[model samples]
Target chain A: MRSGYYKETIVEHINLTDSTLQRAWIGIGLLLVIAAPFHFEFYGLSLITLMMITAIGAMGLNVLTGWTGLISLGQTAFMVLGAYAYAISTESWGWPPLLGFVLAGIVPAIASVIVGVPSLRLTGLYLAITTLASAFIVNHLVLEFDGLTNGSSGIFVNRPVIFGYAFDTDAKFYYLTAGFGILTILACLNLRRSRIGRALIAIRDNDNAARVMGIDLRAYKLYAFVASSFIVGISGALYGIFLSFVTVDGFPFLLAIEALAILIVGGMGSIAGAILGAVFLVGLPEVTSFVFSWMGSSAQSLLSTSAHEIKGLLYGLIIILFLRLQPHGLMGLWQDARRTWTLWPLKY
Target chain B: MNYLAELLASGLAVGAVYGLIAMSFAIIYKSTGLLNFAQGEMGMIIAYVAWSISTSVDGNPFIVALGSIGFAVLFALAVERIVIRPMMSEPILSQIMVTIGLSVIFRSAIILIWDGLPHNMAIASGNQLVDLGGVRVRAAQIAVLVALFAAIAGMWAFFRYSRFGVAMRAVASDDATAQLMGVSSGKVQMAAWAAAAVLSGVAGVLFAIAYELSPSLYALGLKAFPATILGGLDAVIGSAVGGLIIGVTENLVGGYISSGLKEVAGFVIIILILMVRPYGLFGEKRIERL
Candidate 1:
C-alpha cells in the first residue's frame, strides 16, 4: 500500500509512481470504457457518449474556474463558436473533417483572447458578469447572421470522416468521443504538473503575489483562458457532430451554468472530479426518468413536460447543498473513503 | 422630432426600472461585499406574488404592491439567514456560486409554480397613454418614474438619518473597524439584503405593470449588470445614472439600428467602459494591498 508513498527525487515525484493496485484499477477502468458500447444498448451507449462530450467541456471549465480562480459564465459562447466554426468550415467551405475539427478549437481560443483582453482586467463577480454578457452577445450574433448561421433554423452537420473511415453510427461515435475524452484527461493531467499550470495556480491563489514572484499575471491569465476555451471548443465541435446539427439553442446559457455545476459537484481543482461530475450530472436526467417511471403514469408525464425545470432545480439544489455541506464535492468524499479503507487496521 | 421624443420618454421609464434594480444590486455589494445575482429574481418572484394577489383577491394596486413588498422583506431576511449567513466563511467564489444557484432555484421554482407563461396584473392603467405636449407616455411609465424618484429619496434619507443605514454604510467602508465600533456586521448585512429586496420588489412590480410578469423577467435582472458596472458596483446613485444611460442607449439602438442590437447595447457599453475605466465613472478607486 505504501510502495509509492516515499519518493527520493523530484523526477520520481513528478512521474507519479502508481501502486500495483492503482495501476490495475486504471487498467480495468480503461477496459470498461473501451468495452462499454458493446455491452450497453443504443440508448445507453448514446447517453454515455453524451456524458463523455460533457466531460470534455467540464474539464475545460475546470481549467479556468477551478484551477485559475477565474469565473466565466460565457463557456457556452465559446462552445457555440467552436460548433459553428467546425460546421461552417466543413459544410459551407468544404474543408476536410480533420482541419475543420482543428479550426473548431482555434476559433474559440481566438474569441476568448478577444473577450479576455478587455474583461480580464476585472476579477471575481465583475469578470463573471462580463462573461455572461459575452454569452448573450455571441448568441445574438449567431441569430443575427442568418446568411452564415442559418439563423434560428440551424444547420445540419455531416458525421466526421477522417482518412478513409466515417464515424456515423452511435457506437462508432462513442469510441471517437472516448478517444478524445482520454486525450483531454491526459492533457489536463500533464498541465497540472507543468510550469504554465503552476503559474496559473499561483495567479488563481493571489495575482499580486504571483506578480511579485515574477509571473506575468496578464499573460498567464490569457493562457488559462485560451487553454480553457480551446478545449471547450473541441468539446463543442464533438457535440455538434453528436447531434448532427448546429444551432444557437443547443448552446444555451444554462449549459454554461451546468459546466460550472459540474466543476463544483465533482470537486474543484481535481481532474478526476471533472469526469465524475460530468457522468453524474449528465446521467441524472436518465436516473430521474427511470425513477419517475416506477412512480406511475402521472409522474412519467410530468417528467416528459417539466424535465428541464426539474433537472435545473436539482442542479441548483445540489450546488447549494454541496457548497454548504461538502465543499470539496464527490471527489472529497471518495478520497475520505479511500483513506479509511487503506488504513483499516490503523487508527491514523 | 416627436418620434425621437417618444423614444426618449420610453427609454427614461425603462431606465428607471433598470435603475431601481441596479440600486438593489449596489446595496448588497455595498454592505455585504458580495454580488447578489438573484437580486432580479427576488423582484421577479415578488412581482409574481403581487400578480397572484391581484388576480385572486383584489385588483387594488396599493394592496398588491404593499403586500408583495412586505413579502419581499421577509423573503430577503430568510435568504440572508439561511443561505448568505452560513456562507460567510466560504471563499468569495463559493458565495458567488451560491447566489447563482439561488437564482437558478428561484427561476425554476417560478416556472414550476407559474408554468412559464407571462402574467398580466390588473392593477395599473397599463396601456393608457398620457400625452405631455409633443410626447406621449404610458401611465405605467409615469408610475415607474415616480417610483424611481421615491426609491432614490427613500435610500438617500435612510442612509443619511437611519441608524441601521449608517451602520450599513460603515460596514461597507470597513467591516472590522465597524465591528470594533459595536455595529453588528451580521445585522447590517441582513438589513442590506432586506433593503435591496424592497428596491427590487418595487422595480419588479413596476416592470410587471408596464410590461408583463414572466419567468424571463430574471433576464431584466441580468440587464441591470451593465447598469451596475457602468455606475460602479458600489455606488448606489451611480448605478441609477448608469441605468438611465443604458436605457436610453438601448432605446436609441432599437429605434435606429436593428432591434436585435437593442438587447446587447448595454453589454457592449459595459465592455467599452471596462476597457477605459474598470472602476466605473462614479465608483471609488479601490487600492489593494499585498
Candidate 2:
C-alpha cells in the first residue's frame, strides 16, 4: 500500500512536469495557427477545422469517460442538439450568432444533466447503453420535430459573425475553431487542477470510496456531464458554422461511436490525446485515399467504393490493438517515448 | 376489428424477430456478462449467407435456413476465439468497445461484400395471405410466430435437459467455481455465442421476408438492444416479453398515432422504463457489496 501511494505521487509528478512540455506544445499550436492557412488550400483548412471541432468534442467525452468514469455514447447526440439549436435560434428566431452559440452550449449541457441524473445510478456498461439510447432518442427527436428541425431537409446555418466580423472562409473558420480548441484545452487543464477536478478523479478511481470521503456523488456526476456536454455543445455549434448546414443524417450514432473511438485512441484522460486521436481518426481516410490514389489508377478504381470499408476495418483493428496492447492510447505512447528519451544516458 | 387483428398479428410476427434477437443478447449477456453489439450485424451477414445458399440450391428454404445457422455458429466461434478470447482479462469497458469496433467491422464488411443496396430474400411462402377467419395475415408472419415459439421452447428444453446448457449456466453464475467443477468455461462461452448467433440468424432470415435485406439491417439489431435492456439484460424470458412490448408499442403507435412515432416509441419507453426500474423488469436486483 505504501509503494502504491508512492507510485501514484511519482505519476503525479510526471504529469506536473508534463505541463511544462505543454507550454512548448502551445507555442507549436500558435505557430500552426499562423502558418497552416498559408501552406494548405481550402480543403486542407476545412479538414483541420473539422479535426479541431472533433478534438473539442473528444475532450468532452474524455471528461466523462476519462475523468468521471462514465462512458457515454451520447456525445454526438449532445452535439446534434447544439448544432440544431444554433441553426434554429440564429435562423428561425433571428437571434445573434453569438447568442445562438451560447444557447447551443447551454441547452445540451442542461440535457446532459437531465440524462445523467437518472442514469448515473447505474454503472459501467449499463450507463453506456443508456447513453446509447439517448443518442437514438436524439436522432428520433430530430426527425419527429420536423417543424423546427425542418425534418430530413435539415437547416442551413449562416457563418457566425463576431461583432460584424464574419468567419466566412474556411481559413477564417479554422482560426475560430483553433481559438476555441485552445480555450477548451486550457479550460480542461485548469479544471484538472481545481478541487472539483480532483473530486471527479477521486470518484472515477472509486465512487464508493469518494462517497465515503464526503463527496456528493450526484452533484459531481452531474457536474461532469454538464461540463463535458457544454464543451461538446460548443463544438457542435462551431461544427454547424463551419459546415453551414445541418441535417439529421449528419449526426448518426456512427458519428458518436467515432467520437468515443477518438477518446479511446487518444488516451482517455489526456488533453493532447484528444487532439491527436481526433486528427488521426479524422485524417486517416484522407491519408488512405491519398496513398491509394498515388499507388495507381487501378488500385484506386478497385477501392473507390470500398475505401470506407477499408477505413472501418483499419479503425476497428486499431481499437482492438490499442485496447489489448496499449490501453493508454497514442498519448501513452508519447509519454513512454518521452520517458525513454529523458533516460537515454542512463540506459534504463 | 379486422384492422386491429391484422395489426396484432403483424406486430406479434415482428415482435418474434425482436424476441429472437433479444434472446441472443440475453444468452450472451448471461454467459459472458457482455452485450454483443455485433449480434445484429452477424445475423444480417448470416442471412445473406442463407440467401446465397438458397440461390445455389434452387431456392430450397429449408437447406438455406440450416446452412445459415451452421455458418453463423462457425462465425461466432471464430469471433470469440480471435477477437474476444485474448481480451478476456481486460476491463468491461474495453470488451464493450471491442464489440462496438467489431460491429463497425461487420457492418463495413457486409457493405464491402454485398454493397449497400437492399436484397430481396425469397420468402418460403412467397407473400401468400392466409385467411384467419375475417382477419387475413401473411403466411411469412405466421411462420415467424411459429419460429419464435419453437426457438423459445427449444432453448427452454435445452437448458432444462441438456448437459451443455446446465454447464453453461454454471459457468455464467461463477466461472471459477464452474471451472473447478470441470466445466470448461471457454466451451460454454463458445456455445452461448453460437446459440445467440443461430437465433439471430433465424431472426435475420425471417426479417428479410418482412423487410428487405441490407447493410442497414444492423439497425434492427440495435432495435433489440432496448428489448434486452427493458426485459433484463440476462433474463431470456424477460427479453422475449420485452421484445413483444416494444414491437407492439411501435406498431400501435405507428398504426394509430403518427407513423413517424413508430421508430421513436421504443426508445421513449426505454428512457421512461429505466427511470422507474434501472435494473429493468424481471432483472435480478444487484446487492452492492460496500
Candidate 3:
C-alpha cells in the first residue's frame, strides 16, 4: 500500500488523499440520480423530485440560519411570495414562463430586503419573532389581494415551455428541478469558500468582532437574506409548478418549522447535510406508511387518520433528540462512520 | 355608541385572558432569559386536562381548576428537568429550537389525544349574560377579569415581597453574582417555568370558558407574543397592560375595519414598537459588552 504522505507538491498536500475516490463517488451518485426515474415507479420518482425541491429551499435556509446565524421563521412566507409571483406573472401579466421564474426569485428577494432592513437590527429570538410576524403579514396580504392571488381559492399554473421544449411529463419536470437543485448545490459549495461566505461566518460567530474587523454587518446581513430568499423563491416556483396549483394553505407556518427541522437534522452550516436532511424528512412519511401497513388494521387506520400529527411529533422529537445527543447531526454521524471504515482493523 | 360599548366590554374580558398568557411568557423570560415558544401550548394542554377533569368530576369548576393548576406545575417541572435543563449549557439558538420542538410536540399530542373538534366546557359560568349599564357581558367574562386582577396582584406581591421571588430577580440580573450570593439559578429557573405553567394553565381554562376549547386554541398562545413584546419581554405587569391594549385594538379593528386586519393588528403594533423601541414599552434596555 502507498504511504499516506507521499505528496511532494503543496497543492497535492492540501488536497485529500482520497480526492479521486471522493469524485468517483460523487459521479456515481449523480448517475444514480439521473437514472432514478427508470428504476422507480411514478410515486417514487415524484417523491425524489420533491426531495430535490425541498433541498433547494433548505440549502437557502442554511445560508441564512446556518451560515449567518440569523433565525427566520418567515421562510415559508418568502416561498409563498415566490410561488404567487410566478403564478401571477405567467398567468395574468402574460410573461414568458422562464422570465416568470426569474421574477419569482426577484419578488421574494425584494420582500426579504424590506423585512430584513427593519428587523436585521434585532438579533436572536427577537429577530425570530419579527420573521414570524412578517410571515403572518405576508399570508394576510396574499389573502387580502384577492384580485392578484385569486384569493383563498388559489391559482392554477401550467408547466413551463422553455426554448420550445415543453416540460409536461413528470419525468421531464424531474430533470428540470434536478438541474436547478444541482446548480444550487454547486453555488452553495462555492459560496462556502468565497470571501463573502467567510465574512458571513465571521459575523455569525461574533458580529461585534466582525464589525471591528471592518465587515459591514448591515450590508452582509441583507446580502445573506437576499441570497437565501432568492434561492428559496426559485424552489417555491418549482414547487408551484410541481403541484400545478398554488394556494395560501399550500405554504403553512408548519412549512417554516419543517425547513428549520431539515437544517437541524441534516447538520447546520454544511451544504451536503441540507440534501441529506431533505431526503430523510421527505422520505419519512413513506417509511412510516410502509411500517404502519404491516400493523393491525385498526392501528393502521388510526395512524393514517392522524398521519399529519404523527409526522409533526416525529419532527419535533427528531429536532430535540438531535440537538440533545448529536448537535452536529447526520453529517457528523456519516463522518464518524467513514472514519471507522477507513481505519478498519486498527484501534485508532 | 351601544355597539362600541359592547365591543369594549367584551374586549376587556378577552384582553384579561391575553394578559394572563402574556404574564406567563414574561415570567419565563424574566427569570430564565429564554423565550418559551411553548407557552401557549402549555395553556392549551392544561385547558384540555381541566376539561377532562371537569367532565369526570361532574363539572365541578373548583376541582377542575385546582387539578389543572397542579397538573400544570408538575408538567412544567418535568419539562424543565427533562427537555430544558440539559439544554441549559447549549447555545441560545438550541434553546429556542428546543422550545419550538416542545411546542410542535405539545400541539400534535393535543390533537392526537383530543381530536380537532371544539369542546364546550361547563366549568365556568357558562354563557350567562350580565347586563352592565346597557352593555351585555358574559358571566365568564366577568370571572376572567376578576382572575386577571387577582393574578396580577398576586404576582406583584410575590415579586415585591417574597424571598424566592427576590432570588429569581437577582438571578435574572446576574446569574453569576446571584450564585456567589448563594442563590441557585437552576432552582430559580425551574420555579419560573412552574410559575409560567400555572399562569398559562389558568389563562387557558379561562380562555376556553370565554371562547371554546379547540385545537386552534394554541393560536392564542402565538398572539400573546405581541402582547409580551409590546409590554416588554421581561416586564410582567407591562405585558398585562400590553395584552389589554392588544385585545382592545383587535376588537376595534375587527369591529370597524375588515375582520382580516384584526388577526394581524397586534403584530402590526409590535412591529412599529420594535422600530421605535427595540426593548419594548416597559422593558429594560440591555447594554451589551464586547
Candidate 4:
C-alpha cells in the first residue's frame, strides 16, 4: 500500500534514469562537496562540523514539528541532556567517550518517553506551553543540580581520546563530528523511507485519518518524539565535546527558536532541507556574522560573551525575513528555480 | 502568621504588576489570536519611556507619574502602528517570529539608548504608609491595587456596553461578518492593538512605580507568559486573575521555598496545568480544520 503511495507521490517528481540533464547537476554538486574539504581545509572542515551538528538537531526537530506537526520548544533541552549526560557519564564516571556519547542520546530518548506520553494529547498552543515549560525546566535543572552539572557555574569538558589518540584540535574533532553528522543525516534519510516515517507524515497531516488507516498513532508519535530527542541529545554531546564546556545558558529557548527558523527557512519534511536549513541558517550566519562583526572586539568577547547575543539576534531576524519571502523556504525556492529554468532557451 | 500577612502584602503588590502585563497580553490575544510575544518587551520599552518622561516632565512627582504613563501609551501605540500591525495577518508562527525579532530590536535599541542602567524613580513619594494591624504597608502598594481595579473596571465598563467593544467582539467572532455588519475589522484590529498598548502603559507604570526599570525588564515577557498560560490565553479576566496567582505563588515560593527556585516553580506549575487543563483555566478551544 505504501510503496504504491510513494510511487504516486514522489516518483512523479523525479525518475532517476530520466535525469540525463540533471545528472550533470548532480555531478557538479558532488565535485563541489568532495573538493570542498581539501580547498578550504579546516575552515571547510569546521563549517561542515557545525553544519552537521545543527543538521542533526534540525532532523530531530523536523520529525517533531515538520513530520508529526507537534510544536516543541524543548529542542535545546534534549540537546543539553545529551551534553550534560555525556559530560557527567564520561568525565565524572570515567566511562569512555563513545559509550558516554551513546548514553547522551539514550538519556533524552528516555526523557521524551516520560515527557511526551502525557503532553502529546494536547493540540496546538497548549502543547506548546508544555514544551516551553520543559525548556525552562531543563535550564533550571542544569543550573540547580550543582552536584552533577556544577549548577549555573557550569562544568568544563576535556577533549575526547580515542584509542590512546587525543582529538585535541578542531581539525581532529571536525573529522569525528562530521562523520557523526553524515551518519545521522543518512539515518534520518533512510528513516524517512520507512513505514514509521509515513505514519508520522500521516499523523502530521491528519491524525484521525491516520488512525483510521491503522496507523498506531500513540506508538509512532512516541517513537518520533524519542528519536528526535535522541538526535538532539547527540548534537548536545557533540557541542560539549566541541566546546569543552557546558552551562545552563548553553541550551536556551533561542536554540529552539533558531531550529524553528531553520525548519521554516529550509522547508519542512525533507532531510536535504534540514541540512540546507542548518548550513544556510546556522552555519552561514555563524561564519559571516561573526567575521563581519569582529572589527575591533577582543577575541575573548568575540567567541565567549558578546558574540553569542549578537549572533542570536541576527539569526532571529534572518529567519523571519527568510520565512516572509520564501514561505516554502530556500529548498522550495531551489526546486522552483529548476523548473522555471528547464526550458529557458525555448518556450515549451 | 506575620509571615503570611507580609507575604500577602508583597505578593499583592507584585501580582498587580504581573496582572497589568497579562491584561495587555489577554487584550491582544482576545482581539487578534496572536500571542504578541513582544508584549513583555513592549512593557519594558514603555517602562523606559515612563522613566525618561518622568525625568523630563518636572520635579513634581505626580506630574512625573502622569508623564510616564502618557509616554508609555504613546510608545505602545507607535509600536502597534509600525511593527505589529504589519504582522497582524501572517501565520501564527510568522507573527511569533516577527514579534521575537521586534523584541530583539527593541531590547538592542534600548541598550543603545539606556546603556543597561537601572532607573530609580519615586513614583510613590508621599512617605505615606498605611498601618493594618501593626503592619505598615507602603501607600504606593495600596495605590497599585486600586489602580489595577480601576483599570479593570474601566475595561469592564468599556467592553460591557461600549460601541467599539461590541464591534471588536464582532470582529473577533468573524472578521468578514463583522465587516459586513459595518464593523471595520482593520480599525477594530488597530483599536484592539491600541487598547493593548494602553494596558501596557498601565503595566509599565505599575512596574516602574514598584520596581526598578532596566533593559532586562524585558524578561518579564517570558515570566508573564506563564500568567497567560495559567489564566487561559485569550481570557481578559484570566489575565488579571492569572497575574495574581502567578505573583502570589512566585513570591510564596521565593519566600518559603527558595528564591532560586522562583522561575522554575512557576513554569513547573504551567506544565502541570497544561497537562491537565491544556486550554488553560478559561481559554476557549477551537479545533482547526485543514
For model 2, residues B1-290, the per-residue Cα lDDT tens digits are 87777777778888888888999999998888888888898888998888788778977877877788789989999999999988878877888899999998888888877778888877467457788988777677777778888887988888889999899788877889999999998888999889999999988887887767788888878888878878988788788888887888788888999887788777777777777776679776661222
Native contacts retained, all candidates in order:
0.59, 0.62, 0.57, 0.34
**Local distance difference test, each candidate:** 0.89, 0.84, 0.90, 0.76
Greater lDDT among 3 and 4 belongs to 3
Candidate 4's displacement at residue B167, Å, is: 2.0
**Docking band of candidate 4:** acceptable
> Which predicted model would earn the best lDDT?
3
What DockQ does each prediction reach against the true complex?
0.61, 0.62, 0.62, 0.44
True-vs-predicted CA distance for residue B181, candidate 3, Å: 1.2
Better of 1 and 2 by DockQ: 2
- List, residue by residue over B1-290, the lDDT tens digit for candidate 4: 88888888888776777777788888887787777777877777777776776667654667765665666556766767766677666656566666766777677667655756787755546235678886767766776777678768877887889999888777777877888889877677777776776676666656666666777788777777788778887778777788788888988999898887887777888888776776678777652322
Candidate 2 per-residue lDDT over residues A1-348, each given as its tens digit: 121224357457535444566789868879978799999998888888889999998988888888988888778889999999899999989899889988998999999988888787777887887788888788888888889889889899888888899888778888888888988988898888777888999998998899999999889989999999999999988888777899877776777878878878999888889889999999988988888899999879857868768888878877888898899999899988977777766556
Candidates in descending TM-score order: 1, 3, 2, 4
Candidate 3 structure quality by residue, lDDT tens digits, B1-290:
99999889888888888899999999998998899999999999999999999999988877887899899999999999999999988988899999999999999999999889999887656567888999988788888889888888998999999999999889888888999999999899889999999988888888888778999888888899889999999899899988888999999999999899999988888778777787788999981212
Off by over 4 Å in 1: A1-4, A344-347, B124-126, B287-290
lDDT at position A23, candidate 2: 80
Give the range where candidate 2 chain A is weakest over 10 consecutive residues by summed lDDT.
Answer: A1-10
RMSD of each: 1.7, 3.0, 2.2, 4.2
Tell how far residue A30 is off in model 4, in angstroms: 6.7
Q: Candidate 1 falls in which docking quality class?
A: medium
User: Taking chain A of candidate 1, what TM-score results?
Assistant: 0.96
